[model samples]
Target: MKKKSTNNKKTAICGVLIALAMILSYLESLIPISFAVPGIKLGLANLVTIVALKKLGVKAATIISTGRIVLSGILFSNISVIIYSLAGAAFSIIVMVVVDRMRVFSVTGVSICGAIAHNAGQLLVAAFMLENVNVLYYMSVLGIAGAISGAFIGILASIIIKNITFSI
Candidate 1:
C-alpha cells in the first residue's frame, strides 16, 4: 500500500540521515581546533538533526539524534561520552521541539537555544560527576560557543531544507 511504501521511504531516509550525522560527528572530531574550554566544538552533526526535525518531524529527529549518539559513542567514544551525549541530545532535541512548535523565532533562534540546552545538559552531568558546582562556571564560555555553532548549523539546515525535496 502507499502507506507502507511511505513508511519504507521514511525509514530509508532516517538511515541515511543517521549515517550523515555520524560522518559529521567523526569529521568534527578530526578537527584540531580546541577552545581551551571543555565541551566546545562545532556541533556539525546538529545540522542533520535540525533538518530532520523540520523535514520529517520530531519523532524522526529524535531517532536520528539518539541513533547518532549511540552509534558514534560506540565507534569513536567511551561510556562517559555516551552518557554526556545522550543528555545533551535529549535536552537539545526537547528544546528544539518546543521552540519549533512555538514558531516565534526563526530556525536559527531555535538552534541557538538547542545548542545552549545541549551545553547545559552536559554541564549538569559533568557537575554531578565531579561533585563540584563550580563546573557551572563554564557556561559563559560554552554558551557563546553554542550560539556560534548553532547559528552555523541552523543556517546550513535552513539552506538544505529550502533546496531539497523528499517524498517522505
Candidate 2:
C-alpha cells in the first residue's frame, strides 16, 4: 500500500539522516577547536537534525537525534556524554518545535533559540551531576557560542532544505 511505502521511505530517510549526524559528530570530534569553555563545539550534527525536522516532522527528527546521540555515545564516547547529549538534544528539539509552530521567526532565529536551549539543558545536567551552582556561570559564554554555531547550522540547513527535493 501507499501508506506502507511512505512509512518505509520515512524510515530510510531517518536512517540516512542519523548516519549523517553520526558522521558529522565523528568529524567534529576529530577537530581540536576549543572555545576555552567546556561543552562548546560547532554542533555540526544539528544541521541534519534541523533538516530532518523541516522535512520529516517531529517524530522523524526525534528518532534521528536520539539515534545519533546513542550511536555516537557508544561508538565515540561514554555514558556521561550520552546523558549530556540527550539532555541538550531534547531541549533543543522541544524549543525548535514550539518556535517553529509559532511561525514568528526565520529558520535562523529558530536555530538560535534551539542552540541556546541546548546549552541550557547541558548546563542543567552538569549542575545536577556536579552538585554545584558554579556551572551556571558558564551560561554567558555558552550562549555566545550557541548563537554563533546555531546561526551557522541554520544557514546550512536553510540552504540544504531549499536545494533538496525529497518529501517524507
Candidate 3:
C-alpha cells in the first residue's frame, strides 16, 4: 500500500513537471530569435529536466525529457522536428548524467553542458539522417547561443534545487 501510494505521488509530480516542460517549449517556440538557423531556441524546457535529474535521478529525468519532446512534437511540430527533438533530448540527458556523475561542475555548469549536448545531439541526428554536414556549419554560432540559454535554464534549475526542500 505504501509503495503504491509513493508511486502514485511520483507519477503526479512527473505529470506536473512534464506539463511545465511543454509550456516552456511552446513559449520558447513562440518567441523569435534571429533566423540564421531553421531551428533554435532557449531550451527552457531543459530547466525542468535538469532539476528532475538532480532531484529524482537520471532515469526519471530521462523519462520526463523523452515524453515532453515527443508529445510537444506531436502537438506543435512535424515528424522531422520530432526526430530532432528526440535525438537531442537523448544526447543531452546522456551528457547531463555523465556530468552529474563527474561532480566537477555546479548545477549552473551542468545546465550549460546540457544545452550544448542537446544541440550536438540534434546536429548529429541531422548529420546521420540527412547526410549533411551543413548542419554543423552553424554549430559555432549555436554553441554561443546554447551557452546563453544553458546559463539561463541552469540558474532556474539551481533555484529549484536550492529553495525546494523535498524528495522524489
Candidate 4:
C-alpha cells in the first residue's frame, strides 16, 4: 500500500538524518572551538536537529536529536556528557516546537530561542550536579553564545529547508 511505502520512506529518511546528526557531532568535537566559560561550542549537530524539526516534525526531530546524543555519548563521551546533552536537547526541542508553532518568528528566531533554552537546561543540570548556585552566573555569557550559534544553525537550516523537495 501507499501508506506502507510512505512509512518505509520516512523510516529511511529518519535513519539518514540520525546518521547525519551523529557525523555533525563528531565533526563538532574535532573543531576545537572552546571558550573561557567552558561548555561553549558552535552546536553544529543542532543544524540537523533544526532541519529535521522543520522537515519531519517534532517526533522525528526529537528522535534524531536523542539518537545523536546517545550515539555520540557512547562513542566519544561519557555518562555525564549524556546527561547534560539530554537536558539541553530536551529544553531546546521543547522551546523550538513552541516557538515554531507560534509562527511569529523565522527559523532563525526559533533557533535562537532553542539555543538559549539548551544552555539554560545544561546550566541547570550543572548547577544541580555541582551543588553550586554560582554556576548560574554563566547564563549571561552562555546565552549570548547561544543566540549567536543558534542564529548560525538557523540560517543553515533555513537554507537546507528551502532546497529540500521532499515531504514527510
Candidate 5:
C-alpha cells in the first residue's frame, strides 16, 4: 500500500510538472529571447525534465518529457515543431537515462548530456525536414547553447529536488 501510494504521488507530481513545462514552452514562444541567437530559450521546460528524472526515474522522466513536447507542439506550434521537439526530447532523455545508470557523472552532468543530446536530436530532425546536409553547420552553436543552458537547468533541478523533501 505504501509503495502504491508513493507511486501514485510521484505520478501526480510528474503530471503537474509536465503541465507546467507545457505552459512554459508556450510562454517562451510568446516572448522571443532577445539573444542574437536564432533559436534558443533559457530552456525553462528542461527544469521539469531534470526534476522528473531525479524524483521519478528514467522511464517516468522519458514519458513526461515526450508528452510535454508533443502536447506543446500540438497546442502551440506546428508539425515541424512537433518533429523537432519529439526527436530532441526522445534522444536527450535516452542519453540522460544511460548517463544516469553509468553513475559516472553527477546529476548535473547527466542533465548537460541530455541538453547536448537534445541539440543533436533537433539537428537531425532539421536536416531531415530541410533535406539538406548543411544543417550540421548550425549544430555547433546549438550545442554550445545547450551545454550552458542544460548545465544550469540541471543544477537547478538537482537543487530543487534535493531540498523539496517531497517524496518525489
Candidate 6:
C-alpha cells in the first residue's frame, strides 16, 4: 500500500512537472533573445529538468524531460524542432546524470555540463542533417551561451530545490 501511494505521488509529480516544462517551453518561445548566434536561447525549460532530476531521480526526470520535449514539439513547433530537441535533451540528461552521480559538482556544475552537452548534441545533429562540418563551428559560441544560461537555470533550480517543503 505504501509503495502504491508512492507510485501515485510520483505520477502526480511527473504530470505537474511535465506540464510546467511545456509551459516554460511555450513561454520561452515567446521571448526573443536575439543573439548574433542563430540558435541561442536561455533554455528556460531546463530549469524544470534540473529540479526534477534533483528532486525525483533520473528515471522520473527522464520521463518528465522526454514528455515535455515531445508534447511541446507537437504543440508549439514542427518535426525538425522535435528531432533537434530530442537529440539535445538526450545529451543533456545523460551528462547531467553522470555529473550528478559523480558527486563532485553542485547543481550549477551539472547544469553547466548539461547545457554544453545539449548544444553539442544539437550541433552534431545539424551537421548530420546538413551534411557539412561547418555546423560545428558554432560550438564555441554556443558553449559559452550554454554555460551562461545553465548557470542561471541552475541557480533557480537550487532555490526551488532548497525551498520546496514537500516530497514528490
RMSD of each candidate?
Answer: 1.1, 1.1, 1.7, 1.2, 1.9, 1.1
Clashing residue pairs, backbone N/CA/C < 3 A, model 3? none
- Regarding lDDT, does 3 or 5 come out ahead? 3
- Order the candidate numbers by lDDT, best to worst: 2, 1, 4, 6, 3, 5
Question: In model 4, which runs have C-alpha deviations exceeding 4 angstroms?
Answer: none
**CA lDDT of every candidate:** 0.91, 0.91, 0.85, 0.90, 0.83, 0.90
Tell me the lDDT of model 5 at 119. 86
lDDT (tens digit, per residue) of candidate 1 on 1-168: 999999999999999999999999889889976777754799999999998898899999999999999998898789999999999999999999999899998889999999999999999999999999997998999988899888988888888999988887
Q: Residue by residue across 1-168, what tens digits does model 5's lDDT show?
A: 999998898778878888988887777778867465877777788888887777777777787888897787777679877877888888888898889889999878998899999889988888888899997998888888888888888888888888876653
TM-score of each: 0.96, 0.96, 0.91, 0.95, 0.88, 0.96
**lDDT, candidate 3, at 96:** 85
Candidate 3, residue 96: Cα displacement in angstroms equals 0.5
Give lDDT tens digits, candidate 4, residues 1-168. 999999988888988988988888778878887876566989888998998888888988998899888988988889999999999999999999999999999999999999999999999999999999998998999999999999999998899999986665
Model 2 C-alpha lDDT per residue in residues 6-39, reported as the tens digit of each score: 9999899888889999999889989888877754
Model 1 residue 76 CA deviation in Å: 1.9
* lDDT tens readout by residue for model 6, 51-167: 889888899889999999898888878999999999999999999999999999999999999999999999999999999997788898998999999999998889899998546
> Once all C-alphas are superposed, what RMSD does model 1 give against the true structure?
1.1
Off by over 4 Å in 2: none
